[model samples]
Target: MSAEIILKANHISKNFGLTHALKDISIQIERGEIIGLIGENGSGKSTFSSIISGVYPATSGTLELKGQPYKPSDTMDAQRCGISMVAQEMGTLPGIGVADNIFLGREEKFTKYGIVNRKEMYQEAAKAMEVVGVAGINPADPISRYSLEERKLIEVVRALYSEPEIFIVDETTTALSQKGRDIIYKILRRLQEQDKSVLFISHDLEELMTVCSKLIILRDGVFIEELEQKDFEEERIKELMVGRKLTGDYYRSDYDGNFGEEVVLKAENVHIKQVLEGVSLELHKGEILGIGGLTDCGMHELGRVLFGIEKPVYGEAVLGNGEVIHSPKQAIKNKIGYVSKNRDQEALILSASIMDNMVLPSLSKISSAGLIFKGAEKKFTARQVDGLSIKCREITQDVKDLSGGNKQKVVFGKWLANESEIFILDCPTRGIDIGVKAFMYQLMYQLKKENKSIIMISEELPELIGMSDRIMILRKGRVQKIFERSPKLSESVIIKEMV
Candidate 1:
């Protein structure tokens, strides 16, 4: 690893409207270093990286690359200056081939007489895929043909193809499985070995500790502290990020497996063609039944099937009152709720207001015989916004403008407002900070106490082990094993069945 400084930010700051997204921040990335950026959502990690990589110009201050003033007008400009960023959100364009998505914005390289050469693009894409250790994706297939995780891998390949001197991974790992994560970790290590710099942003502290040589902490868009690898401690990092000591058990303490005798929801040999095969499970009242699996292990699909978003070809999802879940409207009418793994796409209306999203699902309850009461809707939305402690300028603030954690809280708020009895949550805590995650755990326990059945589908093993009464491990679209949660239950025991 070289000690040569590759990128430097001198007192950079950013503002959107009247909101200061980043304060007077200054930082550096040396060659061959993997620096971890940690903070709660909207704490300026992405803003700082964006300014450095030229997604947009900073409001104030300057940046230097290898001792030269670096002011890129756009992402392509940054790319020309040897900087590439894998965004936290899905960056792949739909309807285009995988190769096309990988080489997007650089199609001129493949141009021959004003036409792209398909053969050469495929060859280059395959090489990039091989270098990134990504396989099972055909470059000829449309980008939309792949899952989010697969799309994220394609984005990884795209960023790696440039082989930039400064590579910024902005919260991309949360979308990946263990295999995908390992591939990225390997790439980060290889970058370090080649004396290139990597700016890694992740909500997973354990992953940061494993891969980062140094860690930088940010709070409310201000630089807080920097720690060497030896100073890495999960609790201390959480404290600094939150700016307060979190004093409590992180997960639920009670491990009693005693749940309601009645099954609130049951999947009787539910099948989703190629995705899910003969998956059967029972969710009892007042229980958090966790589903743990690999990314493609059909756990996400199970949530869809149960919530009537996707119809099962073979079997049925029966509710407590013997009502079958045939469509999402039917599921909603029957008091069943679902929080999708894809929060932006499936759960919340990003362009809509917080009040709009919170009141959307409860319109049926808040409406009169022939008209909707606007004041009642506001009251209802405000109650949930306050209850969830969602950080926003106002209830009318756009959901898209809020942080990832606050957006997730809005998802929960909408469901909680609807007062759903059975909840199917897929990756509920994905890409959230430790403080929000702890609050979510406590909320789940509160729901469990209220006798609301929850079916949690997650790729995270620790969360499943920590909060579940019983965990179902899925492998290849089938239930491989089921473990009853106890004081003795550990991640190793659940992981044994997951793999």
Candidate 2:
């Protein structure tokens, strides 16, 4: 027998001022089905999911849930109507305990008369965490104490607690490690067994192929095609998403590991209060130095220290000119840029416009006689936006309105406009689509050719192997091994050092 339709969206369209995010799109979800939504940046993937999850109201559309007219006023309304979502951006609030974040809108359940039952809430939160296979997280502790991956898991637990019939996951797995991904996969399988439905959105084609029984493709705010599991093809999907055949190598073709002798940035015996222990490395001129390890490893911290965002308790990061980096001002003055892993929190200001963010780092350069030129600022911002192919109706559009991948592009554009000599990019392509990833890799290669240095910190081993002149593996706050790039370099060899 055919499966029952749980949700149906007909003639759905969304508009943001002059920008039309979704254009006459229609789709349906089936019970016990896990559908993968694939698209490039700004392809209406998130906008569609947001409409269903009650983040936004469609300018024109009709939604029916179990053959009943469904119109949710807000996220809570959607949840109450048997729909829940784990968004792409960080969803948990800071300065609150994990239990509070898990049961944010439903605290009345633990409220007795006029008082909230903290103990009961904590117990239930603990059980929820356990259900998602997340351990060592105290429900009473502040959510800020946890890492990005841990916070994402907490959001997952929150979504699951709603017991929704239809769940939407929007580009969430890109921030997760293999272990965290396994936990998510297990949850999806369990949901399938229970005859629930899921809308899985991700840029990782291989991952989508593995978890989804069918795929839906979108391009330029239009529905392009849909493919069944039997017809899945990576190249075909890429072509459909971008509306063109992807040409050239995704990463650098040559395996030559040679770099200039001059050390652009050097760290000596750096220590980060239990996160890194006597760790040291050198980033050479025109070299792509890749740092790889588990999510809890100290690579991300090391990047911060190198960029002078965090001061090491023991040692220091020095420049080629023998200048000891002490603060972000000093680092930026010496032409260093940092792209943080937590993009939403540390990298880009969501409330600010794209032009405001792109010109922030280059203000001094564009200023004359202690006065800023609006024309120059606009020109500078325009160059980066056009060069990066950032999808936006206008540069005045807020960064938060753009898709996740486009938001990341704004972060990169600011640094590129500043003309930094050394870049410390931590997970630069975290939530970006494949088309943007290719452009970024090419841009890095171009930068290397221009004699600029880059230190790329990523969790994906394939990316490290593909682009780095050298790969450094860290394990439990220490440098385990540093391998020079070569044709024979493999993830298996690197995994041995990471664990």
Worst 10 residues of 1 by lDDT: 490-499
The positional error of residue 481 in candidate 2, measured at the CA in angstroms, is 2.4
TM agreement with the true structure for every prediction: 0.96, 0.96
lDDT of 1 at 139: 91
lDDT of each: 0.90, 0.92
The prediction achieving the highest lDDT against the true structure is: 2
List, residue by residue over 287-406, the lDDT tens digit for candidate 1.
899998878889988889899988888999888778888898899888888898888877988889999999887797999896887798889998998899999888989998888899
lDDT of 1: 0.90
Off by over 4 Å in 1: none
